[model samples]
Target: MELATKRNHAGEKADLRALVNGQYKGDEHALIERIAADLLAGVSARAGEKPGAGKIVGLSSKAACREIASRLAEWLIRETDRAVDARPSCLPAARWSPEEVLERTGMSKSTLYRGDHAQFYSVVPPGKKNGRAYPAWQFIADVPSHLPHLLEILRSNSRMQVNTFFLSEQESLDDLSPAEVLAGMPFEDRQIVASAQQRMLALPVRARVNKVNALARMEVADLG
Candidate 1:
């Protein structure tokens, strides 16, 4: 029996040994979702093969390809349970260090230390005594500038709070994060941004006491 393969421009087999040597930054569900999407795309691209993905050229028949995809999905679901048993731990921080920010923004350490860059970026410290790490997403492409509204909103200079607010889903922004809405096209977000244009505010974590109290009426939520 042989395995499926995809080749690169150099005619070498592209590595797909993710099971053996992959450092996954995300969880298994997302990986499976991506695979599912890829499968759909490949199948749809083919003109007419009884309404399915193209036969794996390396395989004997179209049924084999379908079987492989089916088995892969089952495997993903089954493997997730085992992964839960293993209890892997990880800390994901999509933040850039001070030096990285300096290189990306063409600014100096002294400038950042002097707190002059606050208007231009969101800076969060990893912990006490550690210098701030900036969220790279805050910066637009090669612009020596920051959004005027973010400057005012993040004025409290509490990086943790500001990052949470921008990253969270906002009801006013149609369930999209403020950061995403800000980064998107103008027409779509014009009303929301315009409505928010006059305000200078800060992000803070709010405790939903009512929701917490409602836990007695339903199954306990996964706090973690």
Candidate 2:
């Protein structure tokens, strides 16, 4: 209903709750997809009736379809994760090139492009081709001090996981993002290092590569 009616945030929350709590329920993932498609049909019908007003809420058809698809994908993933094994999901919100990263981190291009690129940062395949882009979270205040060291202690290797560790929230640090805490200099680093050590002990030694790869796959499908 929210997708079809183009409701605002609060309206969407209400509609979503009603939809979830209503009499209709089936395979959670499939039901959401089917409902989304049905809503999209209503959207299409509205568009067909008035060519210019088809957008329903001033959004282009392509954009609306993309939004619907991503919402559905996210719903499915969330439900699936709840029912099965849960995993960390890092939003690939920003990517920077070597030059941009060098400018941000004040690190040499040689170090960034080194054989062990995963040590300092995680690289994503570029949309253009033939190059990799670094996730911006790898560096905070031009420092990657905790990322490399923390990732190593986890016995997990991946620049993407490194970024995830930095981005993950730490309760010991009063719900602060690890990167935000790590960015603090001098006198503040004791807890930062201690929390990193404690979290490292808590983290299981498993292949940390899957989460980033899954995130990238979602992007390729435009479900990001």
Candidate 3:
């Protein structure tokens, strides 16, 4: 009897021609399909039958349905065994690409290339090719140690409040007035806004004092 072809989660039909031609050496696809078909048929038959009436729907008897289910279970066991035996030797370890590493780390390309602290992380060159791929094992090994610091940085970065007045990377820090900063801050942290404003006010004053001190030192040197 011809078996019904199965489709994947994406609704695309699974290619079983390769398995039928012996190109693949596993019966998992066939076993799963057979089991699913049997279950579906059983459900349909049960739905058609009235409860407590003991009336057979599609099958000759309930015993026939039980036999079909038992056969499917046996076939599943055999297929599972075949699948286990067909697994490749290099199945445990899988290497990830640079893009994947970035995704996991949440670090930008620049940050990954040159870390924030200049020498926190090191990149290993690809083994087979001269490309920019690191060993997945190395990433796994280093994660436990580096993760805490990375998480702290990410947390602090997220907490930082930015607005139109406050330019983080460039522009004037003074451009963002204390009131502006307070306005941008989340409502929950509004109580701490006063302290933040005081700190911001101190920064420009400290800068001005430093500039005056430098000028005074230059004048002394010139006079001498």
- On lDDT, the candidate that comes out on top is 2
Per-prediction TM-score to the true structure, in the order listed: 0.36, 0.33, 0.21
Rank order by lDDT, top first?
A: 2, 1, 3
**Full-model lDDT, candidate 2:** 0.47
lDDT of 3 by residue, 1-224 (tens): 12333323212112222222122334545544554555555565667844222434445545545566566546545444554455332211334566876775444788556542221322334355344543332232112222223323322221122111112211132333322222222222223435544454345433533332343344345545
- lDDT, candidate 3, at 200: 48
Residue pairs with clashing backbones, model 2: none
User: What is the RMSD of candidate 2?
Assistant: 17.3
What CA root-mean-square deviation does each model show from the true structure?
A: 17.9, 17.3, 23.4
Error of 1 at 26 (Å): 37
| Model 3: per-residue Cα lDDT at residue 178 | 22
| lDDT (10s digit) by residue, model 1, range 30-88 | 45544544555456566354434445555434455455556765764564455435432
Residue-level lDDT for 93 in candidate 1? 31
| Candidate 3 deviant stretches above 4 angstroms | 1-47, 51-61, 85-91, 95-224
| Count of residue pairs whose backbone atoms collide, per candidate | 1, 0, 0
- Model 1 residue 145 distance off true place after TM-score fit, in angstroms: 3.9
lDDT of 2 by residue, 1-224 (tens): 85655534433432333233221123445545545655666668765744223564667655665567679758554544443232112222477777786774445678667623434555566555456777654443322322444444433435555455556655644454555444432223234445554454334323223332333343334521
